[model samples]
Target: MKRILLINPWIEDVSAYDYWLKPLGLLYISSALKTLGVEPVLVDCLDRYDSDLLSYSSGSGEKYFGTGKFVETVVPKPDCIASIPRRFKRFGFPEEVFRSKLQQLDHVDGVFVTSMMTYWHYGVSDTIRVVRQELPSIPIVLGGVYATLLPEHAKRNAGADLVCPGTGMKPIEKALLFLGINKSVQPDWFDELSPDYSAYESPHYAVVITSLGCPFRCVYCASSYLWRHFLRRDPTKTAEHIEYLVKSSNLSDIVFFDDAILVGGGFKTLMKEIEHRSIRTRFHLPNGVHARFVDRETADLMYANNFKTIKIGLETSDRALQTSTGGKVFLNDIYRAVDNLSKAGFTYKEISAYIMLNLPGQSEEDVLDSLRICEELGLSPTLNEFTPIPGTLQWKELIERGSFAEDIDPLLLDNSIIPHWWKQGFSLDTVQRLKEAAWSLRRKLSGE
Candidate 1:
């Protein structure tokens, strides 16, 4: 039997929070391997419920829905931006604990690591360093958003024996072939694989993905770059996965991480099946779904079926910014859509409007007006800081701007600090005030 060590690496940044994030990509690979009959062991660095971490922190020791702060430690800067005035941290288990955990794994033939935000390659690099030091010669494969975005840079810096940009199921399959293990059947994208997450202590959330990729090629987003094509599953099959998780795993809250859930350019039959028969499940879309996809009929279908958390990307009120951010939707479209959702019988509090901020040359006033629009539309405004992704259009603009060097340490692109917050007169205080007000209003609307 092949023993594989799957890792969700530590996050290195200024500030890190648990916003219902899990390594769905890594878990998919883990589950896929298990279904293929490999012995997969997980060593998630960001396990908030790790016995070593829980032994130290206060507050009930742990929380549910994979929502809680990670045990973090201050670390030195990467010397490129040592002048940046903020404490950098490694958000996860301590190194000693990590090493001890790795040792406990005994013997593993191979390692699979997952990466998130491209700039967090520092975290990816550090994680690779530890893995290489411990195992020395286990063929390690790196794949995920970071690996996908910066393939060449990661190929050199990540020090992995093999690097998988985007989906590397083929590469993984090839490696397994070399090792004399063969799959009787090929791995299909939509075929549901049973994931056993019992290895991690108190793993609570079940990630239920109904589809893959997005149709909209938003210039700022990497969804297109990652998958390049959109695909959906048989709704009956999707419901079956959700049913199994809820019934067997006891995870009621299942987050759907699809780029667009209901755009059903295909699989309309599957969607109708889900609309009719998906059993009790609390759905979440922390990644935010496209509002344009949700019509009165579809919204009603979602609400009636299984969706609990409804979030949509309204980007901003400024029409120019809307076009600038890829012209995904117009202001009036959101207002009418919000009306339809309420008419379909969902409360205003259940609706969330994602207001994006910190674009190149965007004013604070622009961000504020977007927030005002959300407030007026009776939607909760969730402010997300913009980070310049490497291959996106914004990356070229940042390169044209001052002092941004090529391959200059990925840590500068952390969204929390806002690398290029240089729009004339915008103060951090003003940004903070806008965010605080947005949160307060959202809470009031939520009545929570």
Candidate 2:
């Protein structure tokens, strides 16, 4: 059997943290590789559960908070990202530990890497650099959101031997086939297997996905970038995975990375099944939940199922921004949804509404107004700046009107580090003042 290694790289960013955040793409790919009869070893650079972190991650050792803090080292910020105020970190284990871990694996055929948030491509590059230094000839293939969105850049600059864009099902099979590994058998699509989290060399949280893809094309989002369509397993399958974690692993909190979990999709039928069966599990949807689908009954179902924290995408309170950006939700929808969640027995502070700011033509007044509106609805406001995703409808306009390079580096795709600061009718100071005003209102609204 040919040995294959899958690596989930670290994060290079200003003020990074983890919240049940697992690389679902990597886990799914790893599971698929095993199904193909490829003996795979999964290496995670962002190991909060590193055994060496006896004092930090655990005492004599266990990971903290289900998914705990990363072992990060403050590094020099890249030239492209230096303008940002905060010190950035390379979030993961020490380089020596990574190297030592790699050396232990014998006769690895090829290595596969996964990436997320386009801005974090540097972490991917850094991981590749380490891997190449240790094992010169092993082919390093990169895939996931960033690779899918900017394949050319990933191939050219990110140092991957080949980039697998979009879904890795066909590409991974093709990758294995090229190496002369053929499997005449197929495994169950719902691989209820607990990801070989044991490969981490430390006790830590696991990454699992209940479904795939989001149904809507929110102009600024890349949910549709990786997967062109949406699909979900029978809730029974997902529930089984949850049960496995709770019963076997003794995990209490798991995060759902689904973009639109219950968005009028077949999720209702399946979610209902899990609830009716009264599965004793507590789940978290740390990825922003879709507000438009939150009818009173759905809210009640989610609440009864022990979903503790819920975040909604109320990108802007302005009807125009809501309709124009995603056509996914609007003002009346926010009002009704908030009412539903509130009636379903959630305190205002228990919920968060993600507010989108800094879109190319978005107004500062609109940004603050959106925050104010969230306060009125009695939900905490979380501001998420708009970063233009390539291949989306807005990508065309950013090139036409903004300061973005026609050849902007893919690393500039990080949202926390603003890439495209827009001018409201050519007012340069508008960006600064708008951000300040939004922050002020947030403080006042939350009574901080």
The numbered model that scores best in lDDT is 1
**lDDT score of residue 86 within candidate 2:** 72
| Clashes per model (N, Cα, C within 3 A) | 0, 0
Q: What TM-score would every model get versus the actual structure? A: 0.89, 0.88
Error of 1 at 293 (Å): 1.9
For residues 35-146, write the lDDT of model 2, one tens digit per residue: 6677888887766655654444433222434755666788888898678787878887667778888887798999988888777878889999999988998988887778
Global lDDT of model 2: 0.72
Which window of ten consecutive residues has the lowest lDDT sum in model 2? 55-64
Model 2: residue 270 alpha-carbon error in angstroms: 3.6
TM-score of 1: 0.89
Residue 19, model 2: lDDT of 66
Model 1 ranges with Cα > 4 A deviation: 51-66, 174-187, 192-201, 265-278, 401-403, 418-430, 443-448
